[model samples]
Target: MPIHYSIEIADAAAHLFAIELTIDTPDPKGQILELPVWIPGSYLIREFARNIVQIAAFSKQKTIPIEKLSKSSWRIAPTTGPLTIRYEVYAFDLSVRGAYLDQTRAFFNGTSVFLAAKGFETLPCSVQIKADSFSAMSKQWQVATGLCAAAVNDNGFGHYTAQNYDELIDCPVEISDFSKIEFEACGVPHQMVISGRHHADMERLAHDLRLICEYQIRLFGEPAPFNRYVFMTMAVGDGYGGLEHRNSTALICKRTDLPEIGSEQQSDGYRQFLGLCSHEYFHSWNVKRIKPAAYAPYDLQQENYSRLLWAFEGITSYYDDLSLLRCGLITFEQYLHLLAQTATAVERGYGRKRQSLEESSFDTWVKYYRQDENTPNEVVSYYTKGALVALCLDLHIRAETQNQKSLDDVMRALWNQFGRHFDTLGQGIKEHEWETIAQAVTGLDLTAFFDMALRSTTDLPLSNLLEKIGVQSQLRLASNPTDKGGWQDNPVPSACTWGVRTADDPQGVKLTHVLRHGAACAAGLAAGDVVIAINGLKASASQFASLASNAKSGQCYQVHAFRRDELMQFELVARDAIADTWGFCKSKDSCQVNKEMLATFLRN
Candidate 1:
């Protein structure tokens, strides 16, 4: 018999979910059950079993003995008939990676609520969502998920079926009095459900999203992968995140990020939100289907390591913003501004000179996810640098073949060869096999390029490659701490540097980081130091930028700070700012050939 589960709100006010699991044909050798330590798409091992507050087992209405095998596994004694287990999970997490519940709404990922029954994981399963268990005042709430509805009420609270345990947990469930808008893209139904208080223009959201979705669908050719898709969002005062699923995605964003009624101009926050959506949607084929060997069959109990995250995540990052430009959602000048900002961010960090992209991808579990104050000095991000690598590859292919082939061709080949047959073949790209595949697709031997881009710590040659696409690259020192690099005809330079980032504090200003080879490091100033006075005057976070910009070079100042409640004093000398900021602009002298290549690159 198939496995079955039923879930309901045990205590809405207390933030608990009651879940019951039943197996009709239990394994005679003591059935085993386990909860996943981490969810896919997120590399961290969160140990979700720690949230189970209470549990028990029964057989034929008789109490059955249960023994703990490990932190996430349990074994029930052999029984003559059907076996059942009931438990209460404390769901208090408010992020996109776990379960959350309260009077406002309820959300959960099956990895945090359902337990996988050993020896029967491949069997089909059914889940019953008891929406009636919610408080009387919340009876109007509706359920939204990617699961196939087997038998459900008008409110979408009833039975759902899954092909196997993997598909069961891949879709997240969101229940609330949400505002929903539905639209069609490429002959497939799509819906976005939002939960929170906001005065958003739902029509504008649907129009812009339809453009992005249709562009991506047409990019990989027709016949979309999924029949339908859902965008489950939770808007709060301030937040930002997204996790991709096979046919849906869970998102969290600041309420202000939503587009306001009667507002036509796009804000930076809104652009960022759109980029997040594009990034996750592209994963529908790049990661969720065309996956790395290590992730083909995820080992949820422990860490899964792969060095090709640069291709999976970084390539997706590169296309997220580019797709926006191609879809006419943003202007060409604004796209260049975004590119310059990314370049400045990657160049400003000193860590890129120390860690290779492969190492960063391999150590994501320990370093990337769990960052520290010294993260900038030791580790680099595979996401930012990986985008640059993809950019270089695309440019190189276009210049070498005179715009005859590009990364777009390579992606289409990947989809046709691997992604189209993933469900049946269940095969993944090997660890060191990407270079070979790219070469075969483009007919170019990229051994030297791959070695420098993936195995070395040196920065990629971006200036030359950008020129081939009719773009000019410029690098200069930041005008101030808040100067995010972009194209400027006449830019003012800062007088000096403090080499420290400060936040508002009750005392005065709290140092958040001390950059290497900066004035703060030279003066022995470290993170967590609260600066009360500078040059015998009061120091504040509001005025710190002006003081740093106007201070004369080679000037000495007396700094007084408190390190963990101890008063201290030091002499700091103002130093010149480092020239690491980047700016990009259209080249006036670009020939017709270069302009044509640029148009070809950005065309939908």
Candidate 2:
């Protein structure tokens, strides 16, 4: 008597697709069919269900007319017993979270699929997907889901059963010759399936991932809640993101981003890949388990608002690289470098001047996902500021308790208190609940910390906190090499200094801005100027970087630029670069304190 549904898809064209659904129910009387308005991980994404077209209903293998029940709901006429519902979804967009259908292949997120039973949210359900027969695919084309039982077939169909709607939504299926690597961590089976051309050291990747898993488990003082863990990496031609689930994570990254074993040790591409891994891994604890109260019982129809996204995403960001350090995947110096980079990015963002972390977290739907030119001016990223806020809070806790407790203690306490009880309640901890837990763990009132750091634009006391850990963060005016009108800090020969903020723009080598007092600025230039030629040779940003990679400081050159609809010429004098002049620091004292704090933080 369990609810069951099956889908049959027809690959009609390269950019067109069709799917039919058959559903079985005990009583179809007064039954209502509904499509989820939005999917988790992606907030404010509405109209996803509207892509479903040409919907038809059938009963006993006979065609029946379906009645429009509501905006996102439909009803079958004279629903007396079981019925079969069929629909066509337009899958033209090749996005990870949306349905994509083309001559090449097709992909789908369960939110695009509608469930005919409205009140049966808690009921058990099963799904069967009919694949394309032309492709010589096997059952090895794995199906990933939190669903209890799944069955595969040779006729291009995969069958899966879920305990409820939540379970169904968490499973994402990809059909391809995915590169899968399996290992064990903390006595649990771990699998990483990467689709696309992965050109990395597989053995090293698996080994490092295992260490990360083991470290996370030990930090929690218990094994992961799930018996199996899967990392579904979708390496498309050009994609960049990931979404976390209970037992799996859906990642969309560029195929070229998978670094080879001996690629540049400090390449941006490699750093980004590491950051992505850390981000998703941290989510296993933060977003998947220690969730926001609003997300506990998710309402797929609308935005689930919470003022604690800083804790969810920002705190997760703080821990991502720290987890890397804990697992020995990155050294303490490397970890500091990453933090310094994040600090520089946050400081450069003008949006931080306008938006508070709490406001940014609440308005994630309207701001973060839908970024535009004004975004840099109006919205601050909760991820950036939230991480800083977490850093500040961790330092505050450590300082107050004489390095006896830190943010790790707060996370463990949350896990012990709410994470252990989430299964029974089916929701996440409330915002206020965090305050109570913080107090319980730190024995200190966090009202000021939350109000100023999280809810307001109070500048973080990063210097004092970092000093306790033996690091120093200071900001000083330096030469701006990219700027046309700024002073350039010239260094002696044999030393190197390159200062320029370059990005790919339709216009040639677009110089976004010249650093104040930088070589380019001191030579006479301004922001919005495009560098057409360097040293009498036409070049782009990439080409210029390649040429300058070997150039030494105190180098002189003739630079040509287009400024304000006019061609201009200037002489440039290169300067010594101060790379770490933008953010707060941690001195030797602070480093020692932090090391001690880390020990205590991880101990209990």
Candidate 3:
């Protein structure tokens, strides 16, 4: 028996969605229903059921007794006939993971709205959307999703079919008067949809995405998996996020992240946005189809733990920016700058010394999502470090095989073995099998490598691996590597560094964050302290920033700051600026080896 859901944009002013669920065959011993605690891709357990403002059940115009079994579950008292469950869900989360509804637009992930009939998950499901109220405002409003439309109108109003509950939830829907365009990648049609205001270069986006998508398709072989793909985005004031699906992805970015119709320069924000796209799109092959064993059949009710998120998300992270370089969306120098920034991030964060990628992947629920000022001091990001690990492995594999093989070969091997055959096998490689599989593919023994990279917190052997690739890495001084300006200036010796990150405040300079183990942290300056003076003279954050930029190494100065209405004074030594920036250059001797290896690494 099929479960059909009818949804309406009811009460858009109040941000409410009314949904009616019909179950044809209910369990004789009471039917169980539950909303997932979290969505895949996003590790946090966002209590989606909390958004249910009201619920009721009915049968033949009579009220049916519904018992609340848990926070997100309910049981319908044994009913011999068909049942109808009607509920209202409040949708206001602005990110890509949940749901949102306003006069301007309506977006929702099915996990936040659809309730699963526990025992009937394997049955087909149908979704019917009624958005009359939304259309009354503007006829241009349309729905965009990767879901299969069974019976629908030109504007995307109608019934959509899914093989099962999982397929239904995997396709998030966006309804708005959005700017949408279509293009083809490797013979597969694709759609790009965006909400919010902007004069985006639609053709430019299509051209770049065409290159990215086509390259990925050819990377694993011809004939892409999905017949169609969709990119649902919401451009906002200043936001960024992405959640991947089987055939589509939901993204959120700042308005400025989109390239202006005539602008030629690609801002860092724009590049980051593109990286988010590549990251999520890559998952179409890595996570969505490749199937992590633990995620093969996700237990949506609880956490499905896996150690290979480093492989899933981490490798994707590594390739996200690398894809840009490979596809010619950005230059090689820019790629190195991005890589250096990631290195600086992992190195500066004191947590890498304390946490391993395996631990970071597992503790995401407790630590990564819920972060504080101490996060940098205590937690290492699996996404960032995992990318580093992937790069290290790529370099190692290339060197061991004498530039004949690279990480690209390893990924294709995995895709062919696991992702390509997911439908037949319904499961994936076990946690303990990756090393053996990698050995078989690359013919290299990676025992010591995996141990240090995943099992222990030892720093990666970056210099040695790059040397084999015919590139050199060196720590240098000057403007911050992540400052978005290309490495155009020479390193100067007089550059001064501070241990504190400051922001301007009405009262004075506010220490928004103080890096641990730096001069500021050692001198007792903490986050949230307002610095009113330097050497007893008034200074704003900007003023102090200028003074510190030209500061000489190893100097002492009096600091005056206030901690919650208590003024204090402390003497601190000016340490040399942290030499964390790494500059990558082609070894003058092996320009040919560098060219060959780099070409092999970038090729599909």
Which candidate number maximizes TM-score?
Answer: 1
The C-alpha RMSD in Å for every predicted model, in order, reads 1.3, 6.0, 2.0
Which candidate would rank higher by lDDT, 1 or 3?
A: 1
Q: Quantify how close model 2 is to the true structure by its C-alpha RMSD in Å.
A: 6.0
Candidate 2 lDDT (Cα, whole model)?
0.69
Q: What's the TM-score of every candidate structure?
A: 0.98, 0.81, 0.95
Where does candidate 3 clash, by residue pair?
none
Over 4 Å off, model 1 = 135-137
Clashes of 1: 0
lDDT of each residue in 1-604, candidate 2, tens digit only: 2566665445537343455554566344655777778777777767766777678877777877778876788777765456777777776655657666544344566777646477777877787766544243344454444445566664235667777777777776655556778899989988787766667666666777788788877777676878788777777787898777777777777777776677545455555666777777777778777788899888876788988888888888887777777776676666676776667667655567678988898899989888753465568878877888888888889889887778889999988877766767656888778878898899998898888887777667776776666665655333233321111234222333434566676656876655554566688866677888888888677776655545567778788888888999988777755543343333434345567765554333
Candidate 2 displacement at residue 385 in angstroms: 1.1
> Candidate 3: RMSD over Cα atoms?
2.0
Model 3 stretches astray by more than 4 angstroms:
478-489, 552-554
> lDDT of all the models against the reference?
0.90, 0.69, 0.85
Provide the clashing-pair count of each candidate structure: 0, 42, 0
Best of the two (2, 3) by lDDT: 3
Q: Model 1 over residues 1-604: C-alpha lDDT tens digits?
A: 3799999988888899999999998889899999999999888889999999888999989988889999999999998788999999999999999999999999999999999999888789999998578534386799999999999988899999998899999999999999999999999999998998887788998888898899999999888889999999999999999999999999999999999999998999899889989999999999899999998888888999999989998899899999899999998888888888888988888789889999999999999888877888778888888888999999999988889999999999989988988978888899887788889988998999999999998889999999998999988888767788898787665568888888999999999988888898899999999999998999898776677788888888899999998999988888888778889999999999889999998893
TM-score winner between 1 and 3, please give it: 1
